[model samples]
Target: MKRIAIIGAGASGLTAACYASGDGRHVLLFEKQKKIGRKLLVTGNGRCNISNRNIIAGHYHGHNSRFVDAVFSRFSLQDTITFFEELGVPFIEEDEGRLYPASLQASTITKVFQYELKKRNVDLQLHRRIERIEYEETGFTLYTAGAEEHRVDSVILAAGSCAFPPAGASNIGYDLARSLGHRVYEPWPVILPVTIPLKSLHQLQGIKWDAAIRVEVNGKEQERSVGELLFTAYGISGPVSLNVSRSVNAAVIAGKSPVVIIDLYPSMSGDDLARRLDRLWSDGGKKTGFSLLGIMKERMPEVLCGIAGVDPEKRVASLTPADKEKIAGTMKNLILEPGKPRGFQEAVAAAGGVDVDEIDPATMESKLVRNLYITGELLDVDGDSGGYNLQFAWSTGAIAGMAQ
Candidate 1:
């Protein structure tokens, strides 16, 4: 039997081990952490979003983002669903095609994987970190942290990126790839909250509104998203901020300031909002400006009125057309200048990794080194929030495992 060594034991590593085992092959799965699937357990706030129904190349981003097309073509979304179902994990679809295990517990997926790996007789070595790998024409020799050596016929590097450090995320995967002559891009934290220094906005912390957001870098529109907008004491979060976080973080890394423009009432046009405000004012009978602005959250009206230079205590009937216009405009185009993104400790995924150009997208095998595969967030490709990243992980891991 040929010995195949796989590193990381993460979402991709676990998937690869299951597929690579059997057929006269012995798979050795190594993880530096004490437990397996630490990162997977915390995904989707512990619910574990396994994949997305809408898995497309467009949802992913990287220098060679189109590379995902070839990988997905080999292992499509249906294949992922079927693979998990076969392992006894049925899925439930949530909003935006996000798929989660019916149990709604991340531990369910990890436990099933553990059971399956044990049944397959795959060697799962937890708390054993592969410090370095030495490849030769004969095969490959892996060096563990204790200087123990293990020789294998093939190697798969499924070590994930440094996204959430608390979940055993590290740069060891990049180091191993670089050791083997692969170009590793400096990783940046994406899919996290962005910090804005506006004190007025910070006062509105804990307020969430359904809004539309557009991110601009150097006055050029980068990305747009529509969803819940959350105000944090530090800045903004929620789906709207997370969707555009990649663009905002990239700009900060490039030494340029990024702006996030929010539309509080995305479904309403500026003219429509103005008309609504007119109606509200006309119906006001001895009501204060703050009372008439009851369309939003309790404390939001005062902050917005302050920003628009309108007195919240002023009588609605005393308000001029100019005051109404200013408030309407402020709501329509609420500009926020973002500071820096929260670090990888808070990020759901990372943007950069081993350059995809060095890997075969179809097989996920390294073009520079034969029989060596790289998969998961360790690669350059990263997807948008809402289960896209995990979908990519499943596809790439399945492809690499099935590759000869």
Candidate 2:
């Protein structure tokens, strides 16, 4: 039987090992971490968002998204659900098509992969970091950091991208791809917090609420996301911010200015908000500005009053129509200047990696090297903050696993 060597026991590496081993091939899965799935365990805050119900094309970003479409078509979101179910792991669908294990534990997903690997007779190696990878006429030889050598008929570089070092993420994937004559784009942080200079944001620290945000590059709106926004001491985090961070990073990489405009009241238009303020003034006579807008957090009214140039000490009934309009506009549009993306340690994933132009989308094999396959974040493809990234891992891994 031909031997297959898969580097990195991540979600993609684990999936590739299962498929390649099941095909009557001897599979060796190597991991640098002490245990498998260190990153996976922390995914979705330990709940493990396995996949998403809506795994469409628009959710993914890359130089050539057609590659993702082709790979995902082969193994879809439903296929992923069914595959997990067959492993005796049930799941539940949460908001925005996010899927979590029924046990609400990420360890469950890792355990299922472990059981499958054991049953398939795949050899699992841990704490073995490949230091040198050399391709020969026959096959490939991988030398680990400990000076151990491994030879296999095929090599699948699923080592993942360098984003979260604490989780054992490394740059080995980029090194290996470049060694094999493939172009790799500089990696950038994605799905991470955005640093802002607004000192007022400090007042809203630890506050969590829903909002709609649009990313603007050089005064041009690039993308928008809507979800819960969490204010932090450094900047903003949460679903909406994380979703649009990729665009912000791209703008920065291109030397362009990126800013985020947030709609605090996404559900209400400017006119509706103004009408609501007018009604509040009529209902609550002789109330301070802060007291009139006390429906939200007390700090929020003060911040809004400052942004709209309204006096917190002024009575709501004493406000003119123009003051009400200004307040309404401030609530509808909160502009913020963004700094650089959070460091790789805080990023959920990286935006750029092995260029897809040198990769075959149908088979996921490196076009520049024979029997050299690539998968997961090692590729340029990145998805939104939901379960899309994990789904991409599974799909690409499966295709490479079944490669002839």
Name the best candidate (by lDDT). 1
In terms of lDDT, the poorest run of 10 residues in model 2 is 283-292
Model 2 lDDT tens row, 1-404: 89899999999999888888866688999998889988999999889988888899999988888888888888888888888888998889899989999998999988888889899999999999988789987999999999999889999999998988889998988998888888998888899899987887778889898999999877889999899999889888998899988888788778888888999889987777777766677754554455655456767887777778888678777877787777778778888888766789999999889999888878889888899999999999989988899999998898888884
RMSD of 1: 1.6
Model 1, 200-270: lDDT tens digits are 88988999999999988778999999999999999999988898999898888899988989999999998
After TM-score superposition, the amount by which residue 99's alpha carbon in candidate 1 deviates from its true location, in angstroms, is: 1.4
What TM value does model 2 have? 0.95
Count of clashing pairs, candidate 1: 0
Off by over 4 Å in 1: 283-289
Q: Model 2, which residues run further than 4 Å from truth?
A: 283-289, 317-320
What is the TM-score of each predicted model, taking all chains together? 0.96, 0.95
Quantify all predictions' global Cα lDDT against the true fold.
0.89, 0.87
TM-score of candidate 1 against the unseen true structure:
0.96
Name the lDDT of candidate 2.
Answer: 0.87
